[model samples]
Target: MTDDARELADDVQELAEAQRQHWQNTYTTHPGMYGEKPSSPAVHAALVFRAAGAKDVLELGAGHGRDSLYFAREGFTAQATDFRPVGLKQLRRAAQEQGVAARLSTVVHDVRDPLSLPDASVDAAFAHMLLCMALSTKDVQALAAEVRRVLRPGGTLVYTVRHTGDAHYGAGTAHGDDIYEHGGFAVHFFPRHLVDSLADGWTLNQVHAFEEGDLPRRLWGVTQSLPQ
Candidate 1:
């Protein structure tokens, strides 16, 4: 690689490590910070998964697993992954408490790396606000490919991302590639074209706009399916 390319790769690695530490500390301090209720996108994804006849669900960035537990409760075997082990521990505790331990599993995973799952293993995948993390455009695209690799043919993917129209889109420490860090949290606000690019080779189903949280973050709930 060229010198500049090497520097950028190093920077991305440093940033990813920093963010992982930040998340670990955050979950350690806050514990179940997002509460037990599933996000609106997750609820919608469950319905879509059921309609697609998906018996198993893979959830990325499933911190504390609110949605994972919900899916287990709804009768789908759920595999939840997050970079933070603390968060996954909390998710495990919650799953046991909710009597869905057998139906739910947790893995500590970083989305930047390839998924540990086997090819065509999962029936559905869901990722709420994960693709919009501190990932570069390349990293996000790689993650999309990994999701596709794990999902069965005709498998569905429902994901949510904070878009360029959000209030915080450009209001932070710019890391280039549309990524910005604010209050020690980095986000890669998605542009419309990025969304369209990610959907290439897949059947784009819907792009529904929605808002959430006290800041009322604006996001798009995207659904797509692989060709059978």
Candidate 2:
């Protein structure tokens, strides 16, 4: 890699570590920051997956496994992964308490790395607000490739991301490319074109924008299908 390229790679890694640490500390400090209820996107995706006869699900950034537990209770076996072990532990406890332990499996996997699961395995893959992390455009493409690799032919993938219109989009300190270091964390806000680029080579099904959270974070909800 050229000197500039190497420096950019190192910066991405540093930012990722900072993000991981921020989330780990947030979960540890406020165990219920996001609460136990299933998110809107997850609920909708679960219904859509069930309608399509999808039985196996792979969830990325499965924070506290809130959505994973929902999938389990809905009769889908879920592989929930997160980079933070603390979040995974909380998920395990939640699963047992919720009586869905047998249906849920937790793993400590970072989204930046290629998925270890075999190709064409999961019937569907789901992620909630994972796309808005401090990931560069190139990293998003890599992550999409991994998601496609693990999904079965014609498998569905549903994800959510904060849009550039979000209240916090330009708040705090800016990092180039619409990313900003905010509240001791990094958020990479997405524009409409980025979403289109990411969904390239796939069958983009739905594109909807909605506002949620106290800052009422603006987000784009997307659903895509891998070609058979």
- Find the candidate with the highest lDDT and give its number: 1
Using TM-score as the measure, which candidate wins? 1
Model 1 earns a TM-score of 0.97
Off by over 4 Å in 2: 1-5
Each model's C-alpha lDDT? 0.93, 0.89
Q: Extract clashing residue pairs from model 1.
A: none
lDDT of 1 by residue, 1-228 (tens): 999777777777788899999999999999989989998898999999999999999999998889999999999999999999999999999998999999999998999999999999999999999999888888999999999999999999999999999999898787777888888998889999999999999999999999998787899999999999
Please write out the lDDT profile of model 2 over residues 90-111, one tens digit for every residue. Answer: 9999999999999999989988
lDDT of 2: 0.89
Q: How many residue pairs clash in each candidate?
A: 0, 0
Where model 1 places Cα greater than 4 Å from the true spot, the runs are 1-3
